[model samples]
Target: MNITDLKIKAAQIRIDLMTMITAAQAGHTGGSLSNTDILTALYYRVMKHNPTNSKDENRDRFIASKGHSVESLWCILADLGYFPKEELTTFSQFGTRLIGHPNNKVSGIEMNTGALGHGLAISVGMALAGKRGGKTYKVYCLMGDGEQTEGSIWEAAMAGAHYKLGNLIGIIDLNGLQISGKTSDVLSSEPLDEKWRAFGWHVIEIDGNDIEQLISTFDMIDHKSDKPTLILAKTTKGKGVSFAENQISWHHIVPTVEQLNLATIELRQQIEALRKEEN
Candidate 1:
């Protein structure tokens, strides 16, 4: 898909995830909205993934380290035919595989995440194994900014660089706010670029919500280099929705009936505008 098409797809994804969260009455709303564009760009354009063969060894691997914000991932996987879209309604419900976090039982999910700090470590292992096996696949791990506070993340960061796993790509959804409040206030991981650089990884910063920037940055990465790459994707907490954008409470709140209707209308407008631009 072109840039315009990708934007439209992202807007639709926002709508889909919002509806899912509202229906389920549970989700990491702000984080999911913040990372929708990043996920869209990866799944639709950058990553080498196959819905028909979820276990294709050659396909790239994606780990959601900040896994609570999985509503968007679930919606995207379903849309891509990893599972039936109708199953989305069962999300977070009793006896459903589509729980609040990433479940490996689900066809497209690589790991069971949501522990906050273990994703990067697991990704490091996967990348190292792929390197040793002479596999060409890349491991992309998406982590939340709040998750950077965990000592384990830094440990994985050091290992990723120590092994010089160029195929290991880490993306932080630096949406500023977490469930508590702004990340800076919660536990600042400021000077994030310098910190990653100190860890011996190549660092790149970009607008996380911008599909164009996300795609271009991924394209420009040298996955074969001697250093791992970290993308500091800066974004608003609750993107796309007027009332929710940058609001901390939206981190884990389910949209009220009125809020859901308003958000849907706003996102549909964006979708329509992008569709017209596509034409």
Candidate 2:
């Protein structure tokens, strides 16, 4: 999809995520919204993978380390025909695979991820393997800025640099908000770019919420570099809905009917505006 179509798709994904969260009555709303465009850029534009041949050995690998916000990921996976879209309604229900976190049981998901700070480690290993095997696949990992506070994340960071996993890409949803409050207030992970560079990563910073920027930055990834790449994607929590954006309380709050209605209207307006530009 072109940039305009991708923008509309991201907005539609926001609406779908909100609808699922409202129906399930639970989800990581703010973080999901913040990471929406990042995921859209990957699944729709950057990454090479097939929903039909999900097990293809050469397919790109993606891990959502910040698994609490699987609503957006789930929506994109379902839409890609990875699974039945109807399965979305069963999200968070008893005996359903579409729980709050991602699992290997999900067709398109590469690994079972929920524990904070694990995604990078897994991606590092996968990238190393791909390098050794001379495979065409690349590994991408997504995490929240708050998640970087975990010691395991740094451990993986060190490994990524040591191994020079060029095929590996790490992206942080730097929305500055987590469940408790501002990420800095909870556990500051600022100066992220400098820190990643210090750890031997080639870092790129961009507005994660902007589809065009996200696409362009991903395109600029040095897939042939001897060092791993880290994208500090500055984003706004709860991005699409006016009332929820950047508000900490919405981090994992399930929207009420009124709130959901408002979000639906807002996202629809955004989609319409994007479509108008396309026309």
Q: Name the regions of candidate 1 deviating beyond 4 angstroms.
A: none
lDDT of 2 by residue, 79-164 (tens): 89999999999999999999999988889988989899999999999999999999988899999999989999999999999998
Across 138-240, the per-residue lDDT of candidate 1 in tens digits comes to: 9999999989999999999999999999999999999889888888998898899999999999999999999999999999999889999999999988899
Worst 10 residues of 2 by lDDT: 270-279
CA error at residue 95 for candidate 2, angstroms? 0.5
Model 2 Cα RMSD, 1 decimal: 0.8
Task: Estimate every model's Cα lDDT from 0 to 1.
Answer: 0.95, 0.92
Model 2, TM vs. native: 0.99
* TM-score of each prediction: 0.99, 0.99
Off by over 4 Å in 2: none
